[model samples]
Target: MTTRTSHVDTFARDRLPPPQWQPEFLFELPELQFPDRLNCATELLDRWVAQGQGERLCLQAPGGVRWTYADLQDRANRIAHVLVREMGLVPGNRVLLRAPNNPMMAACWFAVMKAGGIAVATMPLLRAKELGQIIDKAQVSHALCDAALAAELQLAAAQHPVLREIRYFHEETPQGLEAAMARQSPSFDNVHTAADDICLIAFTSGTTGVPKGTMHFHRDVMAVCACWPRHVLKARADDVFIGSPPLAFTFGLGGLLLFPMSIGACSVLLDKASPPMLLEAIPRFGATVLFTAPTSYRAMAAQAGQLRIGAPRGGSLRKCVSAGEALPVATRALWKEHTGIEMIDGIGSTEMLHIFISADEAHARPGATGTVVPGYQACVLDDEGRPVPPGTLGRLAVKGPTGCRYLADERQRQYVQHGWNLTGDAYIVDEDGYFHYQSRTDDLIVSAGYNIAAVEVEDCLLQHPAVAECGVIGVPDEQRGQIVKAFVVLREGHVPSQAMVRELQDFAKRTVAPYKYPRAIEFREQLPRTETGKLQQFKLRSV
Candidate 1:
């Protein structure tokens, strides 16, 4: 593979970890092979149009705007022209993108890639402080953001000298990027980037309170599409993909954008994909595949009867994917009972780029994260980095076509050790070769000399009808090193009372081992969640 590029800003390339620190990449599958010179944007967008799928629907927004492959390519090409000719964006310059999951956000992402600029997509909900960290870390020179989401970006740019320019899109002002796109040529020859060229920088949620930028190559993006989607998802060209995770997150990036586009499928982009909005859109658009978190699935299952009004007869949803957090067994069972569809549970991380362990509908087990995707290799390893015995919980490690490459972060060495990406998740692989998630290594609760997975207690609580949502964590205790504490949100018509707590405690005791039941339960209006909807158990523990 070629190493050098025409990039003027080689900061990302220069700052990459030494070759010895990188995971051993495997492109053994025929589909995983790639040409030495490749630009992902050209393959995912332009190539589809060149192959006569130009008129095929690529994106359908909530406001009734539909864009075909050709439409997307044209918009992206024009945006690329504006970045180069007007903004002086050079190859490998980092470009920040901020917007909801809409057509233009996708266009901006493709445009940055097409122009050979690294695309750093930020979650729209991030504040100035959070955005400032990303801008400063990535050394972003330019930004293309939705007008509605520009306030924070502007504030972030004001604090960083490297962020020299910010361009707004879909704004009424003539100075907006849309205006520039309208004046430029629609056809663009994408920059000839190497397959290993850094194309995206996805930041972690900073559970440790310091975000790390995960660098992914162009081939990494194509690798994810070839692995998970080809093996587990097996989606078709006509499959209508819909999801709630923000595109900034790798889960949503793969599910809503890369996977669907790679298969020449269309996707429904919702600026706000709440349970009600997702439920309504599925029947209206005849969505065949849905992607969301376990929490959302549980919420929808509780309101399944009310969703029948506009839902397709026999249901248009053929597959449901749960990620961004561990999928609770109770949520999976409830979803299957309501929709007649098994929720496909998988485990992935921003560092690896997409889901590497998953099971197809035919093979999905209730509590397992599923088998490793075809192109990846996974194992549970102990502290010494040796593989743990089957059924023993240890750190989950994986290595394949895509792996961790944190930009200029010393933590890269900690994440990737002995040529494997230690994904921070604890798991156990059964004799049957299925992987079962235990908890994040930090989430393991050691109570009275017993290691209890927080998810286990939370899953048990979710089975109770009165519990709408809950997050379990370990709190300090003098007698016991730490004790299980659960923060719960009660369902409507359910009032919190000492009697109710006792009933829930008894219910959990019957469900799991008596010692695993939460010793302390606190009722709240709702649980803390990240922008992507993953439960903030760390926050609950702090409280």
Candidate 2:
């Protein structure tokens, strides 16, 4: 088995999670069955051009920046040649990718995958210290970075001896990626990699602590493309995807890049996407699908009345996907009230690669995230690792074509129990088989005898006009074992006064169970969030 593999640098394969700690994978759908030797880049990029659909736009940006399937494949192929012929990048070498969402960055990702190198993509916003951590952890040898974000990566390369080569893409130098690609042929034969070969080393967001590297196989990449987009999204060839999540994050990698490429659909890349920017671009660029977090959706919903959403001429936003964090019910209602598009909410983790549980526009429920996506099975498990009754709160465990595989981490055992991937989220399987997200298992607030999910209170608070953002946490209390405390960011017109606090407290009391209301509320100018837009509740509690 090892002799037939394509990888010459075996660092990623050597550090994979132990066999006993791995979760079971399910490939029930025929589309999920990939060949023993497959390169996902060929499936996503080359196949479309092979089918004579090369002229179709695959990627688009502002200022008339666009690339057809042929253009992207040519760029990717040339880049792949540059990696093997110029940089001496071995098949399994880890290439660190640091760039904002752009055409060339997408090409670099596909180029690495095509050359059989493990692509270790990182957020461009990461500083030198963070970059060094990933460099040291993944032992990344080569890097393809944007010129704008070169300072930190250069500093990281200087500190980490494992990083032997660093190449800049956007620089207009003789040593830049463009200059190197210009000399190479526009077509190259892709490496024949095993289906189980490590293709991507996606690092976690490290919202809790140090980030862990999650490795994925080539078949796993194609499985995500087949399951979510085919079953839940039902995306069409004419659909154009636009989003705020960075390509470094798996959510963005799937929604903004892979999923779109899988169907020959167009995806718009935004270097920086704010709510106003997305709303304005949707019309100018004719974006039919939007992918962002709950915070961005809440902000855009406030401006929805200012423009006609889903209108072909005025604005085109037919589908909206909400993830990264739990979606607030009030935020969902507000978005629909304004835009008339039911937001598709999903729950996914870095370990799982992309969304495993999601729903479409028609089947979307208000509070429930969704039913188990096709090609997957989910259940709520108690602490003893047994199935819990319906409507019972417990840990959410799922088995699918893609499962958790942390690279050389002890926490791998914690994430995978009973041969199932235990997504640290607390959820309930309803009587109708719908999964309801409550909170993170460790984030549930046990106040007195009542069990309170922090998001439920935060959702109620967001319904009030004054509330812009809020995070609920459990703090020590003398009376109750733990009291629900809220750190809130108010809207521009609302001041942080005792009167406003009382009004919010009373509003929460009226919204859900009285015990679930925040016992104390503190106002802030802003709340701390990870680069991916998930609220940092741990930071809130410390404050």
- Evaluated against the true structure, the overall lDDT of model 1 is 0.86
lDDT of 1 by residue, 1-543 (tens): 465675778999999989888888888999998888788998899989999889999999876899999999999999999999999999999999999999999999999999999999988767776688889888989999999988777877888989987889889789988888889999998999988889999987433435689999998999998999898889999999998988988888899999999989999999998788888888888889999877678778856645542123266788888886667677788787777777788888889999999999899998899998999999999999999889998999999999999898888888899999998888999999999987667655655434466776787799999999998888866445568899989999999999999999998876655667899999999888999999987788677
Query: In terms of TM-score, how similar is model 1 to the real structure?
Result: 0.83
**CA lDDT, candidate 2, residue 244:** 90
Pick the lDDT winner: 2
Q: Each model's TM-score, in the order given?
A: 0.83, 0.83
lDDT of 2 at 190: 94
Q: Write the residue-wise lDDT of candidate 2 on 117-175 in tens digits.
A: 99999987666766888999899999999999898888889999899988899899999
lDDT of each: 0.86, 0.86
**After superposition, which runs of candidate 2 have C-alpha atoms over 4 Å from their true positions?**
1-3, 205-208, 312-314, 443-543
- Cα miss at 229, model 2 (Å)? 0.7
Consecutive 10-residue window with the lowest summed lDDT within model 2: 444-453
